[model samples]
Target: MTNARIAALAALGVGALVLAALGAPPLVVAALVAVAGALEVVGQLGPIALRSTLRTPDAVSRAAAAAAALAALVTTGVTAATVCAGAAAVVALGVVWLEGLVGYAWREATRVVERLPGYTAPHSLGARQQVITAGWYLAVVLATLTADGRSGELVLGLAALVVALGTAAAFVLVTRAAIRAKATVTARIAQALRSYDAPVMVYLSGPEGTEYQLGVWLRTLERLSVRLVVVVRETALARVVAGMTSLPVVSAPAMADLEGLQVETFRVALYVNNGAKNGHNVRYRELTHVQLLHGDSDKPSSYNPVTAMFDKIFVAGQAGIDRYAAHGVEIPADKFVVVGRPQVADIAAAAPGAPLRTVLYAPTWTGFNQDNDFGSLDPTGPAIVRALLARGWTVVFRPHPYSLDDARSLAAIEEIHQLLEADAAASGHEHVFGDRASSTMSIVDCFNLSDALVSDVSSVPADYLYSAKPFVITQVDDGPSDAFLDEFPLARASYVARLKEPGSLEAALDALEHDASSSEREAMRSYYLGDFPRDEYADVFGRAVEALVASRCPAPAAPVPGTPGGAR
Candidate 1:
């Protein structure tokens, strides 16, 4: 519990005890009990509306509620000074503990059901349990209020007892139904898999919020001719992917569970990121493992030594292969395949001399560690956005989703949003921020809407190259030097905004106005995204995947001796 909750509980419990000790009226003690009960309900059920996952009230919270209810019962008995009321209070306490135990069991049962393969526990399960628990607490409050030895108190106490029992019975029924439903779903999924024959499988395994990495490849995978399945190692991700696409999705969180999938016809498995869980699927040698890193960029993730685990690494162009050698991470030449990024096929070429200019300022996120912290949002983001607004350019501010993982990046994002929103209201400029820029519009959409781009040393700039538009790459250090340019070759053809320099941002904006690097950008576009025609890039990737699947298919077993097709 938070400190505030603990304080509240202590105050409620202490106040009830003091009121009883001072011979205060019974109604006053009951009011405190009622407020405590309401607090418990709010604490248990409030967060359910905000979260996407199943959130259950923990044992500590339940114990705290029980303590408050018991304290209220004891105070009522003492205030009345009746042996009959004290005996009734003891009975009420027993019922409350019973209710808590049943609630705890129900929560555990739901968790077990959720872990079963192919079963995603519905949100309704948590909602219903919390409602029933709330009802039980309310019943305890009512019983405590009526526990005095008055003439009609017995009838009221009995009614409250009946309500509490009804809630417990309802909880038991819900738990049983959830478990049965999960078993039925698991059986149906297993039956379907027994007949399914998918030659290509996309195996992704990441934490809850990393679904975006898998999302980037779903459309491309759907365009392939071969039958495919998407297998995930996180149950939450599996549930999300199922909602996002029509393709079959399986959650195999353990090695044994993965083996039980029984995908004998599977020929190839594609992976998106270099998550540690990739090792679990890579051990299956019968399936050819291929790495399709989410995007091609100058970051070290593009050339990690772990890429050697895959049988093949599909990249956008020759620069991807050259990057490995440059970074001194070697894999055999034949393992590399240039499948031009089909996702960028829709990015339109830049339209020069437009009447109104718009710039997309998309900085990357702070990565897993300090070595990967290439984001410029903290120190340079507000300055860059202000420069664009000052130059009368509409701004589309889209930061990386993971950027919010850092407090500083989140604050910077909010600051930029405030600036854009206020400027839009005042100057009549059409600025995009909040969900419109971050969620509703894809990066490709942002690229088409804007005339120029400003971003960090990440995939946004690399992908933005498809437009052949002028872009400014932000450098948080002193300025771009030979080593920086050599490390990030895509920067060679673009304006570099040395954020440390006082006027470097404005200089890059001015350079963008003149289209000074048009020729270099066009050249780098071919070098980075490959020379494939925009219309045919997706087909290139699809055909390459089909060829790999065919090449890796298991050789047909010899016909059984004495069978119809046998030599005998």
Candidate 2:
């Protein structure tokens, strides 16, 4: 809980104690106690408006709130009020504790059972508990307000005790049944996996929020002829990926659990990133591990030394092969396979001469560390967008999802969004920002809608090359120089927007309007994205998978029964 919230609860408890010492009116005491009870109920039930402000209360917060409520109840100096408040407090604590236990049980159940398609967890038990707890608190508060005398107070106390005990027993029974249901579902999933036979397995293991890396390859993998499965190291990721694709997803968090699955039938395993958890599956020597990086770029991640572990590395083009050599990361030349980027095949080429040109300012994110921080959003993003708007061009501001991780980058993105939104309203220019730019329309969709591009030293610019349109690539630290072009040869076909130069961005935009680099971009297209026919780009990846499968020698025929140690 936040410190402010804790301080508020502490103040309320102190106020209750002071009021009781001074002998505050019974109605005032009941009001204070009722407020405390209401806050607790709202925290537990969490209505939509309060969802962001009220989190699941911790044991410390719960106990503090209960103490305050008890102190207020005693302020009335009535036995019935005190007894009723105490009973409500116990029920509230029990409900919260049981809710937590149920959530943990559900998670454990999901881990044991591979998630089946269309399976949703039962949430009604927790909902029922919240409703009962809310009603019990309301009843106690009403009994305190409407009770006429001592006889009436005694009746209210007895009724409160009965309801609290009954609710506790009912919760216990419901929790036990939910746990048993989880175990049964797990058994069913295990029984179904025993006869499974998928030859290709996509192994993805990373922290929770980086699911986008795995999402990039799902459509392409689905297009392959071979039967495929997705395996993840985190249970949360398994549930998420299962919903994103129709393919079977299994969560095998431990090495032993992974080995227990039907992996002997898998001839090849594909990986999207070089996360540490990948070591769990890489240890298996019999399977041919292939690295299909999430994006093809000049960034250091493209040539990571850890990539050497894979038997084969599938890249978009020759640029991918040469990137490793330039960075002095040694891997055999035969290990590189140039399967063209099938993702960009659907991106429409530019149709120049529009009256109002739209520039897609898609900056990348600051990478894992300084060495990989190639994004320009924090440095030149606002200036770039301002310049484009100044020139009467519509702006489609699509910042990288990971860029939001940095406060400075996010602030800059928001500033640019406000500038565009205000300009859009006044000048009648349709500008895209927020979810429309980041979520509703994809990066590829943004590419098709724009005439030119201004982005950082990430995959966005590399992928935008398929559009055969003019684009400006920003320099990270210094202004454009021979060193920058040498480091990112892809920039040879782009207008360089030097970070330090006063008018370098405007100059690039001016050059782009005239289509000065049109011929150069056509040549670099083949160099960066391979020379595959546009119509057949997706087929290249599919055929490559077939070749990899055919290249593996067939498993030796099962040995004949009872002759020479089971050898045929």
Who wins the lDDT comparison? 1
Off by over 4 Å in 2: 1-84, 87-104, 111-187, 194-196, 252-262, 352-356, 550-568
Off by over 4 Å in 1: 1-63, 78-188, 352-356, 556-568
Report the C-alpha lDDT of model 1 over 1-568, residue by residue, as the tens digit: 3336645755664575566456555566667656765665565552222111212233333333334444545545443333333343444445445544444333322322222234444435657756765666565555555644456666656666666667767766875675555444434444455557778878888876688898888888887888787888765567667767767777775565566655677888999999998988899999889999988898999999999999999999888999999989989999999988888988897666664488999999878887687889996798789888999899999998888667988889889989998899999999988899878998888999988899989888888888888889987777447878998898888898888888888888788778777788888888888899877876988998899988987679999989989987
CA-lDDT, candidates in order = 0.72, 0.72
In candidate 1, list every pair of residues with a backbone clash. Answer: none
Worst 10 residues of 1 by lDDT: 47-56
Task: Single out the weakest 10-residue window by summed lDDT for candidate 2.
Answer: 46-55
